[model samples]
Target: SVPGPASKSIITGAINFPFPTLRLTLAQENLSQFHDLDDWGFQQELEENYGRVVKLTGFSGYIDRHLFVFDPVALHHILVKDQDVYEEMPKFLCLDLLVFGEESSLPWGTIIANIAKTMMPAFSTLNLRGVVPLFYEVAERLDFNSISCRTSLELIGRTGIGYSFDPMLPGQEQTDRYARALRGLFVTAFKLQLFIPLLPILMNYCPRRCMAQEGGKLDGSEEGKDIMSLLVKGNATADAGMHLADDELVACLSMILFAATDTTSSSMNRMIHLLALNPEVQHKLREEVLTAPEHLDYDKIDALPYLDGFVREILRLYPPVPVMFREAMSDITLPLSTPIIGSDGTIMHTIAVPKGTSIYVGLAAANHDKSIWGEDALEFKPDRWTKGKADSVETKLPGIYGNTMTFLGGGRSCIGFKFAQLEMKVVVCVLLRSFSFSKPDSGIRWRKTGIMPSPYVNDEPKLPIVVERLRA
Candidate 1:
């Protein structure tokens, strides 16, 4: 039992450990279609299968993992108390490979700090303030007419990169080309997922050219200086240290755009869907926005208890980063308030773990856990936050600001956490002020993109809802 949740996987999945990998063997053919992957269906599966804690042993095809469903007290000991013994898990080790086109430390170590270091500066007040006008510009452009999700992504590319692309903005071949490129990259990701994990057998002898296929030539130039340029010119680039390769640029910017455009936009669209269904909550939120102060300072925006609660509830109910991974770097014992029930999971005061284990932390699972969040955990109840009754609980949870690792906690938490909150608050204010929206005649459901969990992207966020200008 590596004390830390981040490093539990690799440690527990080692040959010496007893947990079984979730990756099904070829014999188990229908694994992928195990569930319809609908809202409640997937949630139930997670609760039943991944919801429990175990130390998995041996490999199963592409996956090597040990899910830990230990009690909250045990979670605290591993995460905060004995954090050093555990670092990030093995699966998460390659985050650099997938996200930054770089290498991640086997034992998490300073990787998260590196992330914090590289990205935090980009969200500085000056930089954040600079993005607001652009935020409005982008949102307004999308609101003008019904657009496909892919088109919205193109809009993101243009607005974010400072290019004038009209893939959705009328006829612009330049914009059209960018859209094609973006589609190609997404296709690459989808295909790579199926072919990868050939592991030492195939990857070692694999062609370097194939492995080195980059996302390819996205236009990073914008008006004066975009965030990409800022990073290129800022301290992150100056302090690039050997790890900051030129290859890291597109990937880094990709991640930023994913966070900025995809996650934020998806969230706003979901809020619209949720509100359309719940008129009372919508009315109250609108009322709150109407009373919001004029200046729109970051803190003031965050200070709206009802609004903040609504966002938090939405995040808790429909988190974007549904899952995360970590690898164990060494042998350690996991201290637990709850004991593993199996033979290998015997209630030894502590659990043993080995190196190379892949630990998967289901943030969504833990967030909605019945034991921690109370019986109402499954239901959407924003009042739990506003009421403050849940806040007073003296549990092993991560604490309000840093406790719950939604934006992820630890050295690798989301640096843009503050910025994201500000953006959401601002958008909520703007939309709530401008209109009272409702769903279209045909009922709509947010589809999944598999990256972030729900309020899915089936239509690329075309909610099919109609909006009338609210009385001024």
Candidate 2:
């Protein structure tokens, strides 16, 4: 007998076109066993019952066949080996275009690669050191629960484009036109559920909530000698086809602001929450940070073993973006590390994914796969790093950092991953040195929307932590 459900099962060996489709009505016996609600839950359930790879069918009437992959070998194959065969889904890109315009995302792959290559040096550790004091200044006024969003804004402002947006600075009010517009834009765009295909048309008709036109003339304080300014200045000197249009420049600025703020903040919120829940770990981390050299530089921070492990563990356990969506550009066979019994009673070494199939790369699931990480896979143990954690896993998971699927891998990996890591390390070091964090109460919980996951209390996006100031 095959591994899948028996009622609508087909035999193996004779390759079928669409493979066996799991009906949603019978989802309880099939898909529901894995996950019916959220991405994290789905990945956990899938790995528990179906092992590495599972074929899902009948997804909200659009998709016919979708593959939920949790195996590290399969992830490596999909993300690294045959990446060209798969690309970002249209929905994600459409949302990007609606929000940031054609310049930043319309031709996402090539443009992003080019932009990242061009701007990589600006965000590198060497050039970013000058902003350390700015972080210290920001950390002095940090509100543990709400600091993530504001601190991230300041970091990106001072470093990314040489501007300052933190309310503490003179003429840098949070209610400033640009800041106000950006905040209003997020609230409005999210309200529209911008991922829907009709958003472009809807936004076009609804001028009040349209983010694409919200900037309204990027003159005065909004324009500066920052990254966007350089891009605009450089574009002015370049040939027509070689440069960005005015709208494109505005979108680039918006994209930078939108992408950096929430993700870094969300991560900060979660990491501190983890530290608070485990008081022993928090004390150990604080001691490490405080005992480090009086002047902590990029190299010194990077050298902290425990801190590195702690951050990596946080990303592994609770990646802000849990699942990555991809569409098969062509029919292809995905190589699997472990073979699975097909629904037809045949031993299958590879998965035959047809063209146009939606594939959800299970990031969190692969991070916690028992086969890769051993029995205590789901537990958050920072010590896992010291004990040959990477070596213990026979199969290599394709990711930019810590041999985990946190930052993803391949051509479309997170371009700002290094910047994000540095920003996080600096903030954690500063905050831990001055204060301690712990859970506010027993009722706090983490939840995920369609996009990213964040913490909540009483059904509101709030992370109230117990904080204590450390004295010299």
Candidate 3:
């Protein structure tokens, strides 16, 4: 039987004895259960079974001993106060290096830190005005009944890196060559993830087979002014450590394309799905969006309160990358906000972790924690943002935007968070202004596919919707 409150452990003169920790098994017996739980569901299970923070070990294969953290205070310690102690998983770093072709971590890390500063204006409220027409044009062309992947790719291609994957004019051949290349890159990357030791060799040869070896330039009106061009030009003026080689340039551009495409598309799909299910919310959003002038600039469109609230709510509830893996760089102690009873009946205020310990930072669970977001934290309620209910809830999550773990926090936070927000707002506003969306007879479900949590129906990534033209 589990220990009761009366069974407290006796403390020694100085040393606090370690409690026997729980073992989270990924063995054959529970593999099905692990797979059955979606990202949010799995995190929920962890917190429910083992307090907000727990140690998971006793794994058989490649799985290593790790600490699972869902408590905000522990999260604050790991991701904010003493982030250097918790380094990003080497596998993830290897993937980044393989994708970006940057061997110099110092320069790449420095560049990532300043990327938002350099690129913010391009994705800013003022600069995004230039792309509003393009966004609307694509929105108007969306079929809505089937795949929206192409629409997202086209958006990122044109405005993000100043490339184009779709045909410019009707009767022209499709410029989907870039899309095909990216598909190959992702497939190769997946293989590399499984065999990370093969990265050095794979990185040397994979680009050739993945359609990135030929080295092609983007064709568009904004060609010279695109982010890629800016990066290339900036690198030219930078020191050797900060400069990107030819292969690195290709890898970096391709990485951005991969990062922006599926994630943003999935997010847009979720927003539409949620809005369609909730007619009242959709109507409110439409009302707010329509209130703005037809010629509204980026700043004007961004200022719409209802729209902002709805987006924030969706991101909070359904972050794309639900959990991230990290490893302890050295021995460290993490402070906890609330004391938890250990397996041996000792109350733990702080947890000590040793070097090489694998750690899972629970992003979705932390976002939905009742202690932080209140009783209705699990529910999808956008009004939390409007009436200042969310503001009242105190949280210590180190997120980059909207005080949520959707974009993460600390030095390694998502750099394109602002760009993503601007893109989402622009897409949502343009779509809401022209069409009223309703859930189709067929329902949709969200599942994690190692890429991001995306809408799926019949075991495929899809969002089926009924779009009605809103008469002005």
Candidate 4:
């Protein structure tokens, strides 16, 4: 944002600053193997690169801050001890500038904060309570071949538009189109899934795998009336008004649909694969889920401690958003219990963080820390989340997540986590009740995406899941 090239000045007197002298090279390196940050064994990389307790510094940015990649102790200092000093980049302008035009840019941090504050109510216990039945429909459809690709099409349509998108009654097709557009809009917002949002019309650049297409009446032609219709009307719900403008309104709603389906589908894929591989853990989780009272309501689902812990453990072992990005504001030196290094050959005994740095906090790595989580960090152990001895340390890692950084920490944690939890629980319950499943063979690997990790089943073993009915 500051004009000209960002200055990369080095400090002559380093010890007086917050960072102790840490080697710069220790932090920055060529990501030669070139997979993804999440797909690669980033925890192992961080551990080997910085020890369990070293600080890493590569890029410097807009503040007196540099990137601080440290263990939990040092991370606690920045996220908690020095909370105000760090925040999400107000706009994440670099991406906007690099990709979309300036008009496409948003004051994203403000938008994100607003989303959390306003939308969180929908994810509260009351609203989250309603998501279970909604999720049950997904599993049912999956089994019965009733679900077309756009599953959330029905859910957000009713919730957002105040009616079902089905138009056999009247104005049904129009409503459905709007709902479908929003769903597609959100799923493809990120750079990875650029199929729908950016590629307004399918051109040559579209990826072969991303060839999934839908025929709509037209995008943005809302004559038939939907949420966009009501949004066009003077009367929108207060929940809808949480957005700053109409564009914000559309984007946020799209985000909701995106959050709903993608997290569920991807996460379920991983959990299902894990269940197949570790039949024992799956049985344990299923047993816990089934133990819930006959009437499956919010309280009953929430009461199942093992189910909750098992889901938390799944998130811990495999966090959806592996890397989070933040930008520095000013020359604010953070107190790190450990040491860090900056890429400009600056030895940070205590890091004298330069401004304008984009900090990538490793969520998956932090979740799997051997030091804090003990040695079995890599294994999927729900007991650690529930019965294990982790009370004292749990409170300290409050980035607004349950116990670990599954949802992240700070004001910018996931607003939809409660809803996500509810969705996961309900689906897990229904699937477990319907069938006892396992991997057809060994050597299946679940690869990671930014949010939706890919479950590469080892053998095309028909996924030969044996299904049986459960009595009501």
TM-score of each predicted structure versus truth: 0.70, 0.79, 0.80, 0.67
C-alpha lDDT (0 to 100) for residue 85 of candidate 3: 74
lDDT of 2 by residue, 1-472 (tens): 2143322322221121221252333334334433322334555666788767877643332345667787777788788777767777875666666555532333466665555554454455655565566556665566344557667777776665556676555434365455445433443554455444555433332223222322322444454434444444555566655665545455556556767777777788888888889999988888898889755876777789888888877888788777888888899888878888887778888887789987879898888888888888888887777532553766678887777888888766776777677778888887887887767655676666435666667767677888888887
Q: Rate the local accuracy (lDDT) of all candidates.
A: 0.52, 0.65, 0.65, 0.50
Worst 10 contiguous positions by lDDT, candidate 2: 11-20
Better of 1 and 4 by TM-score: 1
What residue pairs are clashing in model 3?
Answer: none
Consecutive 10-residue window with the lowest summed lDDT within model 3:
11-20
How much is the lDDT of residue 469 in candidate 2?
A: 82
| Model 4, span 1-472: residue lDDT tens | 1111122333321111212244243322322111232336544665556543333222332223334253565466555555455556543343232122223433455555664565555455655565556555544544211122234445444443333444323222334544454434332444433232334333222111111111121243433223223332322346444534533444445455545554555556556666766778877887776766544888777778778877787887787666565665656655544444544554444545456654556677777766667778788777766542343343255556666776766565677677667666776786787676654543545554333454444423112333455566
- How do these models rank on lDDT, best leading? 2, 3, 1, 4
Best-to-worst order by TM-score is 3, 2, 1, 4
Q: Largest TM-score belongs to which candidate?
A: 3
For model 2, the stretches where C-alpha displacement exceeds 4 angstroms are: 1-40, 59-63, 103-107, 143-145, 168-251, 386-391
> Better model by lDDT, 2 or 4?
2
The TM-score of candidate 2 is 0.79
State in Å the error of residue 97, model 3: 3.8
Candidate 3 C-alpha lDDT tens digits along 1-472: 1111121112111111112132222221222223342534554766666778765432331234466677878888787777777877776776666555546545344545554444444444545566666666655555341235566777777666666677434445445665655534543565446664455554444343333312333332334545555555565567765555666556656656767877777788888888789999998888887878765566676678887788888889888777777888889888888888887888888887778877778887788888788878889888889632366776667787777888878766776676677667777877888888898887677876555666777776568888899886
Better of 1 and 2 by TM-score: 2
